[model samples]
Structure formats: structure tokens, C-alpha cells
Target chain A: MKMVLAILISAILVDNFVLSKFLGICPFLGVSKKLDSAVGMSVAVTFVMLMASAATWPIYYYILVPDYTYLNTIVFILVIAALVQLVETVLKRFIPSLHKSLGVYLPLITTNCAVLGLAILNIDETYTFFQSVVNALGAGVGFLLAMVLFSGVRMRMESATETPKAYQGIPITLVAASIVAMGFMGFAGVADGIFG
Target chain B: MEKKGRLSLLFNGVIKENPVLVLLLGTCPTLAVSTMAVNGLGMGAAATFVLICSNVVIAMLKNVIPDKVRIPCYIVIIAGFVTMVQLIVKAYAPEVDQALGLFLPLIVVNCIILGRAEMFASKNSVLNSALDGLGMGLGFTLALLIMGSVREILGSGTWFGIPITAGRIDPMSIFLLAPGGFFVYGTIIAALNKLTKGRAIKRKSMGCDGCPSAAACGGAGTGQCPPDKEGQS
Candidate 1:
């Protein structure tokens, strides 16, 4: 139990997928302009991260580990692509409301590096099944936290009139992201302090 | 086809339509591995290898792949090449393999590779696609190298791990961290914007249009994404 809590807290606050590690930046910059879209994208990404980890962990250990570890990249990507398509169809048919909120971002999530990064990181860290899931959950929640925080920063930038023309659009947004990331850096040792 | 000449296609990627700066594709790796100049160069070379191979292969098999399933086909082909490169790097250059870590495999999802395949390779001749890939790969490499050089110098006070500051000035280690990566990338884009005087395409122009999945997505033909939420912002 303590180990799970340590992994979860460390993943979220310490090695945040977005602010600290720099994964899923495409969605981070693209879908984070509005608060609603940010929430939608984050939820979709978090769901995909968990699902992909759940699916890939078993395959890596049971099937790919002993004989074919080199096939990890090819196999994992195909699985993720197929999984996203499957999830999208099922969501649309059975739970249209959930699909409506999350559907647009679902297809895009297939190409999201964060999903693949997390899957591979699990193997690299040699984490057990439960710990991997906990880490994924932490990563997902961390991503959501970063998206929500950055979206607020972007909202302020949208209304500000004093911004120079050269710093408009993506540049200013990135600069604001830098500050948010700096704030996250403040939590660097907090995880260990509390959990250790 | 627009009848673009070979040299023009090559030049198009190098300057006019740089994948990183102009197109805004593959921002993840652009920020991740760019902390050190040598690491950035290694990553650029690896991605270039995968990009060129996948582009040529896709261009060759463009007709064989069914139109509806082309995106999946492109991904599989790209993944195969990424795995090959991953193996080769691990064998030949263990240091780069270590430096890149998970990002080497995550290149399978890089928007630049898929974006090029769907936008250029699938429609053009094999030779043209290869050239396009080479050009785009170089452009990506160039951008990464520039960012790597700037960040390493400012953040770590080193160039390619060589001590340039001579220990006279204290290095700002923050430049080697996550925030430094964002700051340098933002400043570079801002500088590019000023230099181009808005001639280059900016993020505002890069919604679903340049996105490779835009074709099969529900947001197809819509310039905006999160289709219904455009007005809420």
C-alpha cells in the first residue's frame, strides 16, 4: 500500500508527464486553448493511458518478453491504434454522451506519444503489474492537472493586450507554459519528503 | 500534383515548410531530447533514418494500401522502421540509445513522420518522397541541433559537453531542465516569427488541416478541432 501511494504521488507531482518530462506535448499545445477542450482532451488521454497500459503490460510480459522484445515498438503501436478504434466505436454505440464529450479526442490520442511513452517506461522501469497501473493512473492525473493549469494560463494570455506581436500565438503560450513548468519544479522534492 | 521539381521539394522542407518550426509537428521530442547538443544530434539522425525509410516505403506501397486503412498502414510501416532503427542504435551507439530512452520508440507516433507520409509520400513518386523525407529530416535535425546548442550553452554553459564558460560564470542549471526547454523553444519560435515577418505558417494555421488523422477523423474539413467547443473560448 505504501509503495502504491509512493508511485502514485511521485508520478503526479514529481515526474509529471507534461510539465516535467515533456510528453504528450502535441495535445498539450493543440487542445489546451480552451478550458473545456483541455478537460476533454485530458480525460480522453488519461483513459487511453490506463487502457493501453492494461493491455500492453500483459502482452509484454506474457508474450513478448522471452523471445521477441525487439518487436515491442511495432507490436505496441499496432495494438494502440486498434485499441483506439475499438474504444471509439464502442463509446459511440453504447455511451453516446461519453463519446460526444471524448470522441473527438479519441482518434487523435492514438498518435499521442504520451501513451506510448508511458507503456514503454513501465517496461523500462521493470515495474510489476499493479505498480504499472498505479503509475499510469498517476501519469494520467498528472497530465490532467497540467492541462487544467496551463489552460488557465492560456486563457489569461488570450485576453492580455500588452503582449508584443512577436510573442503572440504559440510563442507566448509556450512562455506561459515555461512558468507553469517552473511552478511544478517547486514540487520536485515534496513527493519524497511526504512519502519517504 | 502541383508539379513541384525535385530541388524545390527538397528546399521546401529545409526552409519554407520546416517540420518543427513552421509546421509545428513533433513538439514532444523537440522539447525532450534537446537538453544536450550531442543527444539532439543523435536523436535527429535516428528519426531521420526512420522518416526516410518509412516515407520511401509508403510512397512505393501507396497504391497497394487501401484508402480507408491507409493511416493504419502508414503507422505499421513507420513502426517497423522505428524498431529497426531502435535495434541498430542500441547495437552501434549505446550512448545515444541511452540518451534518447523511451523517446526513440515514441517516435513511432511522431506527427512529423506520419504527417509527411500522409501529406506527401502517399501522393508523390518514390524518389520525390525520399527527397521530401530527406529535406524534412534535415530540417527537423537542424531545428533540434539549434535548440540543443542554445539550451546547452545557456543552461549548462557547455557546447557539445565541452566547457565553454571556463568556470568564470555560473551556469543556470535551469536551462537544462524542463522549464528551460520550454523557454528556449518559445524564444526560438518568437525569433523565427520576427525574422519571417509572419510569412511562415504559425500555430493558428495548423489545426486539423495539417493533422494526418484529419482525413478519417470526425473533425474532417473543419479548420477548428474539438469541433463544437470553438465558440466557448
Candidate 2:
């Protein structure tokens, strides 16, 4: 249980998806201008990440590992693409409100590296099925945390008046992100300390 | 179709439409593998290889693929090239393979490759598509090279693993980390914007429209201008 807690904390704080691991950056930079869209993108990405990991873990262990490791890249990508389509359809049919908010982001998730990166990281770390799920959830939460925080910062930046012309747009946003990332770096050893 | 000049097509990618710095596609690999000069070179080369191969193939098969499922078809082709490149790199260049690690496979979903396939390759001829791939690939490599050099020199006091500043000054160390990557990426882009006087690439509102996948996504393609704008309305 403590290990699980450590994983959750580490994923959310220490090794965040957007801040540290550099996964899902397309949506991170693209959708982070407004808080509402950022939250919507986060929820959509988290859902896809959780579901992708849930599906890919078993596929990796039971089918792809022993004999066909070579096919992992092709197989994993196709599975993710198909999975996103499936999730989009189901959401559109059952939960129209949620779909209305998230539908725009679903197709984009198929190409988001965070989902694929999580699956591969699970295999590389050699985590079991349960741990994989925990890690996915943690990663989702981490993505959410970073997106919300960055969106808030972006909102503030929009109202500022002292910014120079050259450093106005993405450059300023990136500088802010760098500071946030440096702050997150302070959480580096907390996982070991807690689990040890 | 009006034929574009071959030279312009090739030159456009290096500066005008650089996949990394200009289009802002494939930031994941750009920030991840650029810790060292050599890793950036290797990653760029591998992605370039896949890009060129897949673009040519896609251009040839454009008529054959069904319109509705064309995205998946493009992905399959891209994945095939990526897997081949991964295998060859593992066997021939073990060092780069280890350095790139998960990112090597992650290239299968790189926005640049898919973006080119959907936007350029599917519509253009095979030869023109190949040239586009080459130009874009070189531009990507150039950006990675610049970022990697700056980070390595400032962050580690070295260039490509050789110590160049052992006694010169204390390395900032942050430049080698994630924060450093963001700073460098942003600064370089900003400088480029200023140098070109904003003619190089326009800084538009971010979201699905700015995204390379915007051409194919349901949100932006269906007349919605990203949800951020949606909230304003």
C-alpha cells in the first residue's frame, strides 16, 4: 500500500507527465490557454491514458511478450488508435454532455505520446497489472495537475502589460513552465524517502 | 496542379517550415532526446528516415486508401517504417538506440510525420512528397542540433560527451534538465521569430488549429476553432 502511495505521489509530483517526462506536450502547450479547455483536455487525456494502459498491459504480457516482442511498436500503436475511436463512439452515445466537452480532444489523443509512453514505460519498469493501473492513474492526475496550473499561469499572462513584444507568446509561457518544472524537481527524492 | 519549384520546396523546410521550431510539432522527442548532441542527431536521423520513407509510400498509395480510414492507413505505413528503423538502429547503432529508448518507438505517432502525410503527401506526387520529407527532416535535425549543442555546452560543460569547459565555469546544470529544455526551446523560437520579423511563422492562437493534427481532427475541421475560443463565445 505504501508503495502504491509512493507511485501515486511520484507520478503526480516528482515525475509529472508534461513537466518532467515531456509526454503529451502537444495538448499541454496547445490547450493550456484557457482553464476550462485545459481541464477538459486533461480529463480526456487521463481517461484515454487509463484505458490505453488497462488494455495494453494484458496485451503485452499475455500475447506480445514471449514470441513477438518485435511487433510491440506496431501492435501497441494500432491498438491505441483503435481504442481512441472506440472510446469516442461510446462517449458520444452514452454520455452526450461529456462527449460534447471532450469529443474534440479524443481524436487528438490517438497521437498523444503520453498514452503510448505510459504503456511502454509499464513494460520497461516490469510492473504487474495492478501497478500499471496505479501508474496510469498517477500519470493522468499528474497531467491534470500540470495542465490546470499552467492554464492558470496563462490566464494571468494574458492580463499582464509589461511583457516585451518578442517574448510575448510561447516564449513567456515556456519560461513560466521552466520555473514550475524546477519547483517540481524538489520532489525528486520524496518517493524514495517515503517508500524506504 | 501548378508545379512548385524543386529548390524552393527543399529550402522551405530548413527555415520556413521547420517541423520542430516553426511548426512546433514533435516537441516530445525534441525535448526528450536533446540532452546530448549525439542523441539529438541520432533521433533526427531516425525520424527523418521514417518520414521520407512513409511520405513516399503514402503518396504512392493515396488513391488506394479509403478516405474514411486514411489516417489509420497512414499510421500503419509510418509504424512499419519506424519498426524497421528501430530494428536497424538496435543492431547497428546500439548506443543511439539505448539513448533514444522509448522515444524511438514513440516517433510512430509524431505529428510531423502524420501531418505531412495528411497535408502534403496524400495530395502531392511521390517525388515532391519525398523532397518535402527531406526538407522537413533536415530542418528538424538542424533545430535539434542547435538545442542539443546549447544544452550540452551550458548544462554539462561538454560537447558530445567531451569535456570542453572543465575549468571554464560552473555548469548551470538546469539546462540539462526539463526546465532547461523548455527555456532553450522557447528562447530559440522567440529569437527566430524576431530574426525573421514574424514572417517565418505566424504566432496564432493555440489549440486544434495550431496543431498538426488539426487537418484531420473533428473539432477543428468541423468549423469549431478550438475549445478555448468556444469558451469565449
- The alpha-carbon deviation from the true structure for residue A97 of candidate 2, after best TM-score superposition, in angstroms, is 1.9
User: Cα miss at B185, model 2 (Å)?
Assistant: 0.8
What are the per-candidate TM-scores when only chain A is compared? 0.98, 0.97
lDDT by residue for model 2 (B84-105), tens: 9999999999988999998999
Per-residue alpha-carbon lDDT of model 1 for A52-74, expressed as tens digits?
99999999999997999999988
Worst 10 residues of 1 chain A by lDDT: A103-112
Q: Candidates' lDDT values, in order?
A: 0.85, 0.85
Q: What is the C-alpha RMSD of each candidate to the true structure, in Å?
A: 2.7, 2.5
- Please report the candidate that would top DockQ against the real structure: 1
* DockQ of prediction 1: 0.58
Clashing pairs in 1: none
